[model samples]
Target chain A: MEKEERKKKVKEEAKEKEGRLTGPRVIGRRDVLKGFATVPFLGAFAGAWARKRHIERELKNNLLEVVHLTAEPADIVPVAINSKPLRLGIIGFGLRGRHLLRATGHAEPQWIDDAKASAASNRLDTSYEDFMNQEDLNVVINGVCDVFNIHAEEAVEAGANIFRQGKGGKMGTVPKRYRTYKELIASPEIDAVIIATPDHWHAPMAIEAARAGKHVYLEKPMTWNVPETYELVKAVKENNIIFQLGHQGRQTESYIKAKEAIQKNILGKITLVEVCTNRNDPNGAWVYPIHPKAGPDNIDWAQFLGQAPFHEFSLERFFRWRCWWDYSTGLNGDLLTHEYDSINQIMSIGIPDSVVASGGIYFFKDGRTVPDVQQVVMEFTKHDLTLLYSASLASDRQRGKVIMGHDAHMEISDRLVINADPQSTAYSEKIKQGVIDPVVPIYSFTPGKKGIDGVASATEQYFASRGLLYTYRKGRRVDTTYLHMREWIHCIRAHIQPSCNIDQGFEEAISAHMATIALREGRRVYWDREKEIII
Target chain B: MTKNHHLREYSTFQALMLVLLRVSIGWHFLYEGLVKVFNPDWSSFGYLMDSKGIFADVFKYMATHKDILQAVDLLNIWGLVLIGAGMILGLFTRLSVSCGILLLSLYYLSHPPLAGLQYIFPQEGSYLIVNKTLIEIIALCLLLAFPNSHIAGIDRFFQKKNK
Candidate 1:
C-alpha cells in the first residue's frame, strides 16, 4: 500500500509539471492583459485626432466669421417654363459659328466622329461627354447663311444633325441656306439670328436683323469702327429687339462672384486693375489656315467686302481677315476687348477718361498691319483706378487678372483668390494677432469644393490659375458659352434684355475704338462722356 | 513551445522597439485613411494627374476613368484602414506589411525622385530617391522578417490557442 501511494504521488507531480509547461487551456487574466497591451495606443490616437480636429474647426470658424463671405456658387437660373420652341438662324458658318451651333444642340457629323474618336483614345478628354450632356435649348435651325459655299453646306449638315451622333446617323430636316445675311434675316421662319461674321460685318448684319424684327446675338468688339457703334445701338434700342453681344465672359462663374465681392467691399479702396492676354501660336496670331478649295469661284468676294475698303480676292484676306485693319480692329478688337469686358462686368468701370496705347507687329511679320504685341493704359479718375491692358501673341506667359486695393488684392480666373495686404488698414488688427496671415490668402473660393479655404496649397492655386480645376457647378462641368447662348434664347422668349445687352455693347465698342485710335494716332484719346464720343 | 522553436525569441527591449515601429506606422496609415474618408471632396485625381516617371500614363489612365477612380479610391481608403488596424492589433500583421509595402511601392514609382522632374504639390523636404515613404517601406520589411506581434499583440491569443 505504501509503494502504490508513492507511485500515485509521482504520477500526480509529473501531470502538474506538464500542465505548467503547456500553459492553461482557458485564457488567464495575465494573458488577457498582454493581448490588449496596444489598446492604449489606439486610445491615444483617438484623443490626439479629436483634439486636432477641434482646434482646426475652431480656427476655421473664427476666420470665416471675420471674413463674413459665403463661398457658395451663384444659383443657376432655371429655364422659363411653358416656353415655345423658338426658331433660329445662323449667319457666318465659320469656325466660331459651328461652335455656337453645337452649343445649341447641333454638331456636324465630322465633329461628332472626331470628338468620339478623341474621347475613346484619351479618357481625360471629357469634351465628348460634356457635349453629349449639354441641355438642348429646344430651338430649330431654320435658316443658314455663309459667304463661302463649303461653309454653307457644312452649316446645313450641322443644322440637320439634331441627334448629335456620329457619321451616317439619323438627321433632322435640313435648314434652308441663304446666299446673303439679308435674306436669312428676312425669313419668316427665323425668329432669332446669330451673327458670327468678321468684325466689319458684325454691326451691319446685326442692324439689319434688328430692323427685320428678329432677335440678334452679335459677336464682340460690337463694331468694326467707332461710327457704326452708335448706329447698331440705336437700331437695337429703337426696334425693341432682344440683343446679346457674345462676351461669354459675362457668364463666367468667377466673374459673377467677383462682382459680388466688389459690391460687398471685400477689396477696400481699389486703386488699380491689370489684365493680360498671351498666346504664342500661328492660329492665335491670326495666321489661320486657308482652305485649299477656297477661291474666287466658291466665295462671294464682293458681298464679303460690305463696308470695308475694297481688296483683291485673296484667300489669305478672306480666311485670315483679323490680320488686316480693313476688316479687323487688330489686337484691340480681337483680344483686348475680351479682357476689358470681363473687368467691366466685375467693376462696372464705364468708358475710361483717357487711354494711351502703343505696340507693333513685332512677331509674325507676315505682311499683317495689326500688332501682335500691344499695351493700353486707361486712367479711371472717377473711381481713382488705372486699368492696365497688355497683350503678346509671340509669348504665352500667363499673367492673371489682378485687382489691387489698400487692404487686399484679388487674383481671378475660373477660381478666385484674395490675399490680405501686409500693410493694410482694414485687416491690420487681424494680421497683428496672427489670425490672418498676409502670406496666405485671406479668402479663396474653389468651385465644386464644400467650402472656402483660408489657406490653399500651391498645387490648388496653380491648377485654379490655369483654369484646370473647376468650371463646375454642383459637380457638373458647364460651358459658359452654352450658358450665354441660353440666356439670349431665354431673353428673346421673355422680351427682356440679356446680360450683354446693347448698352454694354456700346461701352465695349467705344473702349476698344479708343485704344485702336490711341495706337494708330500715337497720342492719348479721351472719351467725351457728355456727347458719347471718342475725341 | 515546440512550435515557437522556429521563431527567434527577442529580448524585452527588442520586442518593445518592434511593437513601437509597427504601431507608429499603423497610426500614420490610419490617419491618412481617415482624413480621406472624412473629406467628401477628396480625390486621387489631382495626384494621379500629376504623376511623373515611367508609370505616369498608367496612373493618368486610372484617374481619367470615373468608375475605376472611384473604386480605386474606396479600395485605397479601406485597404489602409484594415491594414492599419491589423498592424496595431498584431493580427494578420504579415499580410498588412505586404499590402503596405505594395502601396508604398506604387506611390514611389508614380512619383520617382528623378532629376528634372518637378511636382506641383510641394514636398516638405528634399529627397534623392530616398524619401520617407521608402524608409517606411524598409521598416515594414524589417517587421515582416522579424515579427513580434505574436509575442506582445492580440495575435498571441491565436498563436497560443494554435499551440
Candidate 2:
C-alpha cells in the first residue's frame, strides 16, 4: 500500500511538473486551460436557432420520404480455374504493405523477449512493437518489388520470414526482388499480385499486370485519370483475370450486418444517406513527417512521380502524395470514395446521376491543395436516393454511416442500429404487434463486440471496426485484411468475382473521378451511365 | 419518385446540419475526455479550487479529499467522454444525454448564477440566468426532444432492422 501510494505520488508529481509525460513538452497548464476555452458555442443564438429550424424542417420533410433498398449478399464462389498453393507476389512495402504481410500469417508471435527491455515499463507506443509482432506466413510469398531500397529490403525480410515458415524452415528461400512492377508482372512464377502502390501507379501497374496475365488486387481509387479508368477496365476484361479493388470495407462485418438489416426493408425507402471522415490528428492528415532517412539518394523520384508532371525532388511530395493533386485524386478520390463504396456496397448504387461537391481547407495550413473539410451530394435519380458525404481532418467525431428509409434509419459503424419511423407504414404491423417500438431503436448489431471489451482507446477501435486493422471470424479475432486477401485468393483459384472487382472498381474510379471533376470545376458533374463516361 | 429532389436535398442538408451540431458538441466533450484520458496526470483540482459558483466549498472539498476526489475525477473525465461519444455516434444517446444533463446540472450548481458566489477563477464569456452548462443542458434537452439520428446517424440503422 505504501509502495503503491509512493508510485502514484511520483507519477502525479511528474505529470504536474511536466504537463505531458511523452510526445512534446508544449502542453502546459495554460495550454490545457486554453484548450478548454477554445471553440465552443460558436453560433450562440443563431446556431441554436439554425439547428432547431433545420431539425423542424427536416422532421417534417423527412416524414413524406421513404425508399426500400436491398443488400445483395454476394455469393462469391470459386470458378474452378486453379488448385491450392496459389502463388502470390506483393508490390509496395509501406504502411499498408506491412499490414497485408501480417494477414498472411496465422498464429501471432506469442513472444518477443528480445525487444522487451526497450518498453520503458509498460509504454504502449513503443516504435518496435509493430515490427516485433509478426505472424508466420502460410502462403508462398514468391517475389517482392519496391522503388525504395529500404522498402524493398523490408519486403524481402518480411517475405523471407513468411517463406521460411511456409516452406517448413528449408531456408535460402528469399523472394527474388524485381527491378520494376512490369518485370514482376511478367514473371510467370507469380500467378497473382497485390498492388499497394500509390494512386497514380494503380492503373499503370494494374494495366501491366493484366497484360502479363496476373490476377491483380489493386488498391482503391483504381485509376489516375478518366481515360485510365476505361483502359484498365478493358485490360482486366480482355485478360479475363480476377481483379479485386482494395476497398476492404466490403468484408467489414458491421456493413455486412447493415446490408442484412437493409435487405429486411428496415429503412422503408432509402432517400438519404450520410457518411463521414473525421480524423483530427496530425498523422490522420496526409502531413506525414518526412523520414530523416528519406532523401534523393535512397528514393526513386522519377518512378514515384510516374506519368505525372515532373518537378524537383521534394521529400514532402514523395512521402505525402495523398495531399497533392499531381499524384493523388485529392479528398474526393482518397477519402470520399471509402464512404461512397461502403454505401454503394450496401445499396448497390451504381454511378450516381449527378454529383455536387463543396468544401475547403478550413484548418491545417500545410498548403494542401485538397480541402480538409469535404462535403458531396450524390443524387441517385432513378433510385430516389441522395448520398451525402461529410469529411473533416480537423475534428474527430464518432458519426456513423447512416442510410435513411421512410420506415427506419440504419446507422452503420462498428455497430448497426435501426430505429423504426413513427410514420413508417411498412413497419406498422411490427409496431402494432409490439415487436418494435416506434421511437426506440429496434435492432442492434455490434461486430466483434465481445473481443473489443477492454480496448486501449476508442480511436484505435474506430479504425479496427472499419476493417482497416482487425475483425472477427466466428467470434475469433482475425485481421480483416486476411479475410479480404483470402477472398481475392479464393476468387483467383475459384475463378469468380472477388468482393470489389473489375466492374465495381471501374464504377468507383468513374464515380470518384466524377466527384473529383465536380469539386475541381466547382460545378455539378453528371454521369452518362449509358455512355460510360462523365458528361 | 414524384417528390421534388431539391426539397429532399434541402431538407437532408438541414437535417445533416443538425447531426453536425450534435457532432460538434460531441467532439468538444469527447475531445476533452480523450485528451484527459491520454494525459495520466490530468486532474480537476485546479478547476475545483478556482470554483466561483455557489458551491465553491463543496467543489473545493471534493477536490481536496483525495479518495472522493479520485472518484470525482474518474466520473468527470469518463462521463464527458461517454456522453460525447453517445451524442456523436447516436449510440446510447438517450442515456448519454441524460448523464450529460446530470453532469452539466452539477457543473451549473457548482458554479450557479446565484448572488454572493465568487471565486478566484475566471469565467469564459458572460452568463446570466443560463451559463454554458445550463445552456448545454437545454441544448441537450432540445436534442433529446428530437434526436436527428433517424435522419442522420446510427439510429437509422437500428430503425430498419426492427422492421
User: Quick one: best lDDT, which candidate?
Assistant: 1
Tens digits of per-residue lDDT, candidate 2, A427-469, equal 7876676555566555544554332211123343334344422
Best by TM-score: 1
Residue by residue across A391-419, what tens digits does model 1's lDDT show? 99999887889999898888998778888
User: Worst lDDT window (10 residues) for model 2 chain A?
Assistant: A106-115
Cand. 2 Cα-lDDT: 0.70
DockQ of all predictions against the true structure, Cα-based: 0.45, 0.02
CAPRI level of candidate 1:
acceptable
Provide all candidates' interface root-mean-square deviations: 3.6, 25.3
DockQ of the two-chain complex in candidate 2: 0.02
The runs of at least 3 residues in candidate 2 whose Cα sits more than 4 Å from the true structure, single-residue gaps closed, are A1-84, A106-138, A163-172, A428-435, A449-475, B1-163
Clashes in model 1: which pairs?
none
